[model samples]
Target: MAGQRRILVIGATGTAGRQVVAQSLKAGAEVRAAARDPGTAGLPDGAEVVRVDLADPDGLRAPLDGVEAVFLLWPFATAEGMPAILDAVAARARRVVYLSSAAVRDHERRIERMIERSGLEWTFLRPHAFAANALRWAGRIRAEAVVREPYGAAAMPPLHERDLAAVAVRALTGDGHDGATYELTGPETLTQAEQATVIGEVIGRPVRWEEISPQAARRRMLDRGWPPEAVDGVLRAQAEMVTEPAAATPTVEEVTGAPARTFRAWVTDHADRFRAP
Candidate 1:
């Protein structure tokens, strides 16, 4: 059982990492939740919480000790100090499950290569747009009841954070997932406008999407602290999606033995976030 293995969960407070921590605990794994601040990590009582900064390769070594498996979450845009970090992980950990972007950005691919050659059993999970990304509209939706953004036609099968974590737990605790790259998606492909409508339905409000210029959207993203390159990459991905629709996959169900949930279900689960308060 996973109870014998000590799993080191990086980014333990983040979207997918939080779920991994909870599920690993449920599966009886000895979880060492690593965060920059242990007190504020807000993990369960059973966990061995520690301070770890991924940006600092020197400080990363201590956490790898006695860790049988690792749930990696790359929080940076570039692979700076990643080699040293991966080398440290390779020296100790038996396996690693990296949470990567479906876009397969340069940095993600770099980490993938390092892990493959690191001699540790590895699994890559590339998830599509996050359903929680809808929170970006929460403020606007609560105020204006409208989502004003560019690429309203962009189609995406937004995956739920919990579903993504379920697969990570399987790969970490169960066997046969090594060297596998899983492309994950939600149950439906909804356009940006359609997603707005779904939110409106679940929140019992009349919300609509208004198309804006890409330039305006870039400004908004920049104002929110997104770098220029990231903003460009995001808009480019959406622009391509406008014509090429995303498709749902059964990977989450197949791996976790549960059907991938629908966008409507996600909205319902997080309805309080969208509720007018």
Candidate 2:
């Protein structure tokens, strides 16, 4: 195990975080998958699951000990407690790769600035829409093979989680990535309706895109316990995408030396989730 890189994955249970853990272990890194509840994290065998809660920055010290790089996925909507968290990370780790959004929302910008000032080598991954967002339709797809939402024409270059993790692992273990902000996206642009069709094709059924009014969609989301502001933000973004579609980026391939996976490939990988029980 000479020269084994030690990495700490802060959001080890999320979609992208899970992929980062797996891929880092595959690349021969000694990975510590940090979660609030390590016993329930269910990460792969090689990962040393450690208990660490970002909300309670004090808990990070033990997990960050002896770790050289950290892959951070800040789960908070605001930048509260970020300085303390970065302080703890910089105290132990020299490098941090943050999973940031391409939207560069206010909170994301604030956290990025804090990481820069923390004096640790840093990389920001600004990924476009995640292909896993399609999982939001899993229940309806399983029961009725239909997706009901507004702005069926909204177009995005959905990124595969594995691609995002690949870029992250490269930044975590390799050099020449410090101060880099990678704009990550999939290979092609697909409309919401087209994404539904791709899912249907992969699952061997015709899944229909039942377009609803933005108002109705907003109501439904609120009824499902979504914050009013979050619901509004989602609808507004989708509406904008209807007119101005998101563009695909070559950064994924440029960083990982592999072409970004298509939405079809993502669906094929998770087709069983959309199929009947």
Give me the candidate number with maximum lDDT: 2
Global Cα lDDT for candidate 2: 0.94
Per-model TM-score versus the true fold: 0.96, 0.98
lDDT of each: 0.90, 0.94
Q: Which ten residues in a row have the lowest lDDT in candidate 1?
A: 1-10
Q: Count backbone clashes in candidate 1.
A: 0
The candidate scoring highest on TM-score is 2
Q: Hey, what RMSD does candidate 1 come out at?
A: 1.3
Report the lDDT of model 2 for residue 126: 97
TM-score of 1: 0.96
**Which residue runs does candidate 2 get wrong by more than 4 Å?**
1-3
Error of model 2, residue 260, in angstroms: 0.4
Candidate 2 residue-wise lDDT at 163: 98
Question: Which residue pairs does candidate 1 place in steric collision?
Answer: none
Clashes of 2: 0
